[model samples]
Target chain A: MRVLGVDPGLTRLGLGVVDSGSPTRPQLVAVGVVRTPADESVDVRLGRIAEAFDQWIDEHRPDVVAIERVFARSDVSTIIGTAQASGLTMGLAARRGLPVAMHTPSEVKAAITGSGRADKRQMTHMVTRILRLDAPPKPADAADALGLAITHLWRGAVAGASTPGKEKDVLARRARTTAGTGLTPAQQQWARAMRAARA
Target chain B: MRVLGVDPGLTRLGLGVVDSGSPTRPQLVAVGVVRTPADESVDVRLGRIAEAFDQWIDEHRPDVVAIERVFARSDVSTIIGTAQASGLTMGLAARRGLPVAMHTPSEVKAAITGSGRADKRQMTHMVTRILRLDAPPKPADAADALGLAITHLWRGAVAGASTPGKEKDVLARRARTTAGTGLTPAQQQWARAMRAARA
Candidate 1:
């Protein structure tokens, strides 16, 4: 399956696509950043983002759309803009009938570098190794976008694995993590990612 | 001029329209809320909001779009959702080539009521009176939506009025409010509303 990951932001939105046909060796398909002028009105900037993202979706035609979720508790100045940008991505993906997956920054970091506390350099290094690329994707955000796609792909593999023992282990781990009823599929997949990281 | 005001939210979005052809006697054209099931995914919910808001823009064809700005510092739990929903409104308005106006909650309250610290009841009362409605718009969000439109109308009037003395007074007040250069028109209009309220 092909997955498109977006690290959402107002001034600079990072987008990366990965073809995950081989779960063990995901390949990078595209990576770039979409930037809007800081001087533009919020309305115009958002509209431009939606337009550019729509074009990305049309061109990539990925099976799933993944985004790094924005946390309201983090960076009060940037959270709102990040959330707004992510909303456009989510809405666009839904309109296209594509499944939307969201991973927290920590989750993506953990999945990529085996440590939720990994720094940017570590994540970029790991992504370069995993994708077998000559160099890390430019701008930390672009690497983060690729990391989100790889995270989603691995979690999805864990979720849909036919190995009964591994599936049972994942379910047990997810049961402990969920702690509440009615978790979304993406949330459940995050739990699976957490479990796989621990294993 | 016709203005459509949107009080954006994830579960309940309030929408109101007013025809301000006569600066002194604004008339209500439409008022209601758009609701999405809380159980739905964020992507689905945002998509639904965009679709419904597009229909609203097509149906109303307002000269301007007004929305209450979401602050990242306020109510961390709901701030992200509010920002995301408001983003859709702004993006839609921009795509249709309509000017988008944003008023802070305090600014909206001050414009509708005499005080920036006015309570919800005061706002509802003033909205009912301003729109000459027999009763207050049901739900506080609906009243707030109308308040946004009314605020925009009054501010737009203040910004465009040829009264030299009043324009000079507004410009002086706006100079005080704007700490730096490059304020958006909406920001300048907000300053004008603050000046008019004081007057």
Candidate 2:
């Protein structure tokens, strides 16, 4: 499956594309950031982002679009812009009949680095290693977008058999349970793999 | 100037169109609500809203779009959805080269009922009287949408010469000043009119 991951923001939107390779590795297709001038009106900025996103989808032709789930509590000032970008991203993908999967920040971290508490540096390091790239994707948003695509590629693949809406529902329930325990399914999977290797 | 007002919401979006009739009495061109099912995903809902808004603009051919400004502090549970919808509204309007204006909730209330704290009933009542409608617009959203159009028709008319971005900046500054003093420009205008009538 070809997946496009987006880290939605008003001023700078990070995009990463990946093609499913082996069970544990995904091939990097492209990674970049789209920036909208902060001086413009919010609507104009959103329109520009929409235009860029439309172009990206058309060029990449990804089967699925993965986005980072925005939480209102993250930053009151930037939350609205983030949410708007995320909404636009999802809308554009859905309009094209592409399935969209949203992953929490922690989920992406856990999926890429084996720990939900992994910081940006750790996430960048792991994403680079997993994709077998010589260097890490630059500007944290780009790396983060790659992480989102990787997360959906690994975490969402099993649940991907069902309808998109139902798949999200299942993932959401699992996310809630994982949040309650301060662990993600990815983290658990990593732990099991580590134990098996040790044994 | 013809204005299309939008009360942005994920579930039920209210839209109102008005034409510049007389300075004091604008004519209501149309009023209605567009609904997206709650069961649908957020992206699908946004897509439906975009489609409806596009059609509305094509049919009404409004020179400007007036939308309610979404504040993140209001109702955390719904704020994200509201912001997304508002963003999409602005984007759609901006894409079609139609100027977009946003009014605070208090500003709309003051413009319609001469009180920033006017209740829904008073807003509905005044909108009915101003538009000379036989009945209040069906849902509260519809009434609120009309109020937005009327506010822009009156409040925005004077400052309409400037570019839409600059006009919004000026209006935003004024909104901040008005909020601090607990009165909108509309409320002050209403007070002056009352004094003139008494004199």
Candidate 3:
């Protein structure tokens, strides 16, 4: 299954695509960041983001799209921008009849690093190891997007038979319950890598 | 000049159109509300809004779009939805090379009535008189949208030579400064009708 993960923002949006043959092995297909000028009007910025989504979706043709959900508690100024951007992405995906899923930051971190409070550095390291990339993706947002995509694949694949909306609830519930569970088999591999680096 | 005003909301979006021959005289062209099911997914709701915007803009061929600016302090659950809907409306207008303006709720109220603190009943009464309609527009949202369009035409025409973005700021500043001042010439006509009603 192929998935496109989006880290929605007004000024800097991160997009990552991954193809998963097995739940444990996901390969990176593409990764990039779309940046809009901070000085531009909100509508213009949103227009640019919409154009970028159109270009990416047309080129990548992912089976499903996964986006990081915006929480109201996060930076009030940015929350609205992020929500608008996500709305555009999801709308475009829905227009194409592709299923879209939303993952919280904590769920993405826990899915990737075995801890819900994993920091950016830890997420980058795990994403790198998961995709077997020689180097971590540039711009923390890009790596974070990859983590979102991987999380959806790992969790959604398990509940793939359910409807998209129901799958989201199931994944969210699982994320809450599995918060501190030592890592998935794929994350366990990364844990071994961390131990090896320490040695 | 032709203007389309949008009162952005997720479940019930309000839209109105008007043609301004003179700054003091504007004629209503169309008005309605677009309702989306509350149970629908965010993306689906956004798509419906986009479709509605397309239809309105295409039919009315508005020279510009005036949308209600969203404030973060509003109901937390609805704020993001309104923002997203407004973003879609603005994005669509921008795509068509049509200018878009945002008016605050207080600006709309003050423009329609002589006071920014005017209640909905006052707004509906003023809108009914201004539009020369047999009855007030159904669903307060629709009346509110017509008020938005009228506000833009009256205020924007005064600063019509300026750029769209700059005109919005200019109108907002003017609205702030002119609040509770004697009514505009068009508003004076409404005042007479109001006085006649009281008598």
Q: Which candidate number maximizes lDDT? A: 1
Candidate 2 global TM-score: 0.82
Task: Please state every model's RMSD to the true fold in angstroms.
Answer: 7.0, 7.1, 6.4
Quote model 2's iRMS.
Answer: 1.3
TM-score of model 1 vs. true structure: 0.82
Q: What docking tier does model 1 reach?
A: medium
Q: Which model scores highest in DockQ? A: 1
The segments of candidate 3 whose C-alpha lies over 4 angstroms from its true place after superposition are: A162-199, B160-199
- Model 2 Cα lDDT, one tens digit per residue, A1-199: 8999999999899999999886555789999998998898888888888888888998999999999988878898899899888887887687778888889999888777878999989888888888888888776569999889988877765444544676566665786676764334654554454333223
Q: B128-191 in candidate 1: lDDT tens per residue?
A: 8877789888765688888899888887765554447675666656765775533344446655
lDDT of 2 by residue, B1-199 (tens): 8999999888889999989786656788999999999998888888888888888999999999999998878898888888888887887687778888889999989777878999988888988878878887776669999989988877765453444666556665786686764334544454454333223
**Which window of ten consecutive residues has the lowest lDDT sum in model 2 chain A?**
A190-199
Q: List model 3 lDDT by residue over A159-185, tens digit each.
A: 444446665566556655686543443
Full candidate order by DockQ, most accurate first: 1, 2, 3
How well is each residue in B58-120 modelled by candidate 3, as lDDT tens digits? 889999889898877778877778877777777667767788888999998877887899998
Interface RMSD against the true structure, candidate 1: 1.1
Which runs of model 2 end up more than 4 angstroms from their true locations?
Answer: A160-199, B160-199
Candidate 3 clashes between residue pairs 3 or more apart in a chain or in different chains: none
